[model samples]
Target: MSFRLNPFKVMRAVGIVAIVVYGVVLVTGYKKSKVTTTESVTKDMKIRNKDFYKSKDYKNNLTLPNQVVENNNEAVAKELEQTKPAETVDLQKDSDTSKQQTDSKVADKNKKKEEQVKLEMQKQAQQKLAEQKQQEKSKIAAKQAELKKQQQLEAARKEQAAAQARAEAARQQAREEENKKAREEAAKRARENAKKHQGSKKYIQVASVTTEASARGIAKKLGGNFYYKKTTVNGKTAYVVMSNMTDNPNTLKAMENQAKRAGSGYMIRSVGK
Candidate 1:
């Protein structure tokens, strides 16, 4: 198919261009009309010289350019003054909206700061509690250690006391044994001294020694043996003595008579008779 441009679209574009050119021409070159130039002296535009002479009026045509310019300036100043207040009102409304937004942001920030401070305080309180607990635990541990040390010291003291008592008891036992030995030795020595004078004999009447010198002297004394010897009767000593002989009445009488006449002590002994 062949390309075709629509007539209505070309016409519409040409009309929009004509309207734009017309607006440019009107804005760039615009001047006041004759009516506006003459209206500067009167409130409305005056008629020309023909109408003035026909009406028999002396025209107020000596109008000043300064007055016209001044009036126009006053109108422009008033319009500008009126428009400025409206713009300022709109600006004040916009500034109020912006200030409200800024205040809202500040309030939100302060609220967040308060919340953060509360959280920080909570954390600090938790830390303080933890520290207190730790200190308590340390105190408890120290007290337990002190108690254990005291217990150990007490046990050591008791052990030392018991050991000393045991040593004292052993020393006392040793002293008792020494006293017993001494007593036994003294008794043995006394027995030996009492028997020292005895003679050797078998079957003595007693263990003590008899009188010295003769049989006449022997009848007046107790009889015994000195240095006696026998294996069975005693372990290493024996005893011998004199006694009466019996059953020879005539011979015994003669001997008794002889002893009585002499006043000599005679001992009676056993013989083979």
Candidate 2:
């Protein structure tokens, strides 16, 4: 049997191998970078040490002459002192310059602190001003609100007063109209009384009862004075119950209503001699 390659399987295997190779390359590169970083650090340390030593050696070389001259016998001391005084002066000048620079830096720091304090004060002042303005605004708003409330109250009071005045005027006018009507009614009553005196006034005969007691009882129940007259009715003597009222229509009508409450039969008639 011959072994046949599946193209898909072959491609899958190739891809897996390629992936493995890429991962290995990435790992190797990372390790190499770590190693290179370490070597570079070591080289930098060595170079720094070498440079430090060289600087120290240079300083020592420069100081050798001074050391030698100081170590020499007293015969050269005076000569060295005269020769090195200028250099000592220069060193002193350099120290003085350094001290001045330090003092200048301290003064600059103090000036900066003062400026910060001034700025803070300005901010505080601004904040205070803002608060004052806000207070003023609040006061103004309160005053305005109070003024508006007062105005509204005044307006309401005025409206109420006007309404009351109008109601009073209406009541006065109604009273005047009622007075006029009463006066006219009094005059009319006077005229009617005059007319009644000229002739016999009308009266209502409420009932005809055989007994005076019955007549009196009905008149008492009817709440009015009554009189009786003997009349012949059906050839028999009968006592008629009559109300004492005038011919005025209102009086007759009132008596008629009262007689209805007393009994059913009633008649209107004029007074006789």
Q: Which number leads on TM-score?
A: 1
Per-prediction TM-score: 0.39, 0.37
Consecutive 10-residue window with the lowest summed lDDT within model 2: 84-93
Q: Assess the local accuracy of residue 180 in candidate 1 as a C-alpha lDDT between 0 and 100.
A: 81
Q: Rate the local accuracy (lDDT) of all candidates.
A: 0.51, 0.68
Off by over 4 Å in 1: 1-86, 89-95, 191-273
| Model 2 lDDT per residue over 1-273, tens place | 223345456446655655565555555555665666566555433234556756865567567887665565454555555552221124344445555654565457556655766676677777788989999999999999999999999999999999999999999999999999999999999988888676556776777888778766767788855667778889887888787756466777787777676665565454543
lDDT of 1 by residue, 1-273 (tens): 223344456556655655565454433322222333344434332246655644422333234366876786688677666652211124344445555655565557556655766676677777778988999999999999999999999999999999989888888888888888887888878767745744332221222222233332433443222122222344433333333443445544554444344343433332342
Supply the global lDDT for candidate 2: 0.68
**How far in Å is the alpha carbon of 157 misplaced in model 1?**
1.2
Worst 10 residues of 1 by lDDT: 201-210
